[model samples]
Target: MKIDAAVCSSARLARDRRFDGRFFTAVKTTGIFCRPICPARPPLERNVTYFATAAEAANAGFRPCLRCRPDSAPGSPAWGLVSTTVQRALKLMRGEREPQSVERLAERLGVSSRYLRRLFAEHLGVSPLAVWQTERALFAFRLLRDTHLPIADIAYESGFNSLRRFNGVFKQIYQRTPSEVRREGHSSRVDVRAATPVRLYLDYRPPLDWQPLLAFLGARALTGVEQVEGEVYSRSFAVDTGDLVRYRGVMRVYNDAERNRLVVEIFGQEGGTGLYLLNQRLRRLFDLDTDIEEIQAILKEDTLLSSQLRENPGLRLPGAWDPFEYALRAILGQQISVAAASTIAGRLVTRYGESFVDDSGTEWFLFPQAEQLAEADFSDLGVTRTRAKTLREFVAATLDGRVNFAEQSLEDWCTQVTSLPGIGDWTAQYIAMRGLSMPDAFPASDLGILQALGSEGEKAKPKEALARAEQWRPWRAYGAILLWQSLKSGEQK
Candidate 1:
């Protein structure tokens, strides 16, 4: 994946957004590194050094170029490489992340700490601890740059132990104090409205199918918890802190001219309350953090369904807001239209979930967890005794970790979800791809999708339909999204 030195120099000269975040260019004269898309004039070729990751550049004694604000460059899209270990590690870190040893975390990912460390080094060129630390620290750094929260509150919100540690890490990583960084920010953004609707810019790759994707979410959106306007979507979040946070936000999707990233702006929060969660949630939903180029390369040459390749090549199937909630929704979706399934899901949450309101008048139920749902008896809910029993088993399995997708490989999650009573191949594969973060998981048995792919060649049978999709190997999931959209335009929701 290394680039030619000359090519890197040319990319910097052109300020090409395509190369931004792919590599960092350090100026020997100034001892500073910046994204390739930095607006500053290119430096002498002989005096520059290019590194793959920010840490690598910073570790070699180069400070960040203040003009470009290297921290603002989009995060790398994690993909392609058999990164199951990486995905599993992120899940473990995000959920119940304890201030414990990496050894224990590694054990949870079913790999030795040393093996996990090597994986990080191999893919990201940093230790696993460094990756986790950077994820938190950089997020905190962005908050400091964007919001006016006090240092102590920022530390707690950023998942740091104390102000001292936060300051120390901030100085070490950015070569400056957090306050100093904030003070230096040039807030000339013309319409920089930071109140009520907190605006934060998030970036991603290009060629997104914004209209179709938004249309789908708009139709399926729950009544009280979510809203959609054109290409923008907003919702209420029950922060893990158990606080009800509301945000009035609209995302304008566009290719980042500077970072070659997909930039998203979230506005309408007084204190930037849920900006961090919004960033994570948007990353999952819009799938901005995916290596689509790598994925397209894998499925492009397959002979079976090559013609389907041209159908909205940049499609992204949105992921869930909550994993447990998504799992329950998948279970209820069996043999039902998406609209009907969504209605059932909304009812289940409203009836049994916790309710709260935010300042923005947004209301939501804290989606019941595995333990909570496991204890509930859904017999009188109008669903069959079979669906009720299925719900029971599903909840119990999640609570007991018997059906844990956190440790399971993509294949394992797909197989395990189907093994549950109500979940079949389509539902299981959908969960695996979206809920379990399995990129290669695709539900070939999907009826609507198969028909949308022009499967009814007047005489083709179900077996032929499966055979037709043989070429979409590994990334048939992308095609599934397009077919879903096709159905949507016809008001099939």
Candidate 2:
């Protein structure tokens, strides 16, 4: 995770978007850290320093640049590329109520607090607490600038215990009170409107293949729970923000190709934790944090993937909104076509999911809960006995915490789920790919891949497909995306 000075300087000087979230350039004289794509003139090499994360820069006493907005620069690619322990810790930190103490956080990560601190310091150059504080402060900063949400509401949503604490932290980090900063921003910029239809953008690396990614999700979108209309993907979500209080809302996501960012519009008013959770889920849904250049560089070495990589740049693995819902879809998809699976999933949702209406009067349903699905009768859903049994077992495991998706390695989760009835290597690997966001989880036994890589009138064996996939290590999930996209172009024949 060490930053190469010369490489970072070059990227900064050139304003490379590829390195946008990978590193930040902090100006010694200005006491500000900016994203690599920041538009400000580059500073002297002597006055510049690089940081792996905004928290690290903030830890070094540098405030975020007002113009560049580092918080919206996409997540650090290191989260997906670093150690499993760091990955799990980061996943936990991104949750609504993160572990307040390093001891508690370490316990959840199954590592000693000292070792966990070492990992954070080594990779992020900051303590776990510093990272969490910076995250909360930056999110509050964003809400203050971008939306007209009341200051008190902003404080609560940003994880502050009281107005006093929120103001203290804001002043401590940015050297100004929240109201003062907002006033200065307002005076400096044009008139701003209210926070209606609260709009935000999630940045991603370039060359995004929006058409195929949308098509993939659009084709399989379930009714009464999710929809993909043309370029936008919309869904209803329910989050338990502690105390058994369920915050429900609808989110609309679509690509903003001109800006190289995904535009997310939340059509309901749920406070800061809801925004935080929605952001995490949306990032997972679009796989926005992926380093496409790195993935493609490795994947292009494979002969079969080379042509596809050239044909489709910036291809990404589409992720699920919720792991449990995705697992259910995968269970329904076992030995069935994607179309058939979608139909059955839609019916299952309509029957078991909760009904609600958004601010726009769009009737939506929350995807069925684990306990609800576990005890529900699935026989009438037209699913075979084996598939129904597999789904029930999956839900039962989820409800009882047997099939956990929290902070576990992809291999562990895959193995844990595959141990259930009717879930095999393909289903497990597919779940790992989309459910756990494991970039290397390739389903070599998939018939589409077999046909895509095979010769005329013959299909490749699973062993052969896996052997051929070795070169695609660490990015086989994206390779799977390429193969599936090729199927749309009639190249699988």
lDDT (CA) for every model shown?
A: 0.66, 0.82
Name every residue pair that clashes in candidate 2.
157-272
- Candidate 2 per-residue C-alpha lDDT over 225-312 given as tens digits, one digit per residue, 9 for 90 to 100: 8888888888888877666878787878888888889988876655534676677778888888888888878988877788888888
Per-candidate TM-score against the hidden true structure: 0.85, 0.95
- List where candidate 2 sits over 4 angstroms from the true fold: 186-194, 270-273, 488-493
* Model 1 lDDT per residue over 1-493, tens place: 2547888888889987656666789999988899888888788889998877676676667777778867677655532343778766765665532244689888777789888888777776667666566556666776766665655656766667688988987787778888787677634443334333344566655656666666767777776666677545666554443243333433344444344455554433444455566667667777766666666676566543234446656666677777777777777777777788788878787778767665556565566667667678877556788988988998988887768756476677767777877777777887776675565666666666656655355433446556655565666566556545555344332
lDDT of 1: 0.66
lDDT of 1 at 416: 74
Q: Where is model 1 more than 4 Å wrong at Cα?
A: 1-7, 78-83, 94-100, 186-197, 241-277, 298-313, 360-362, 454-470, 486-493
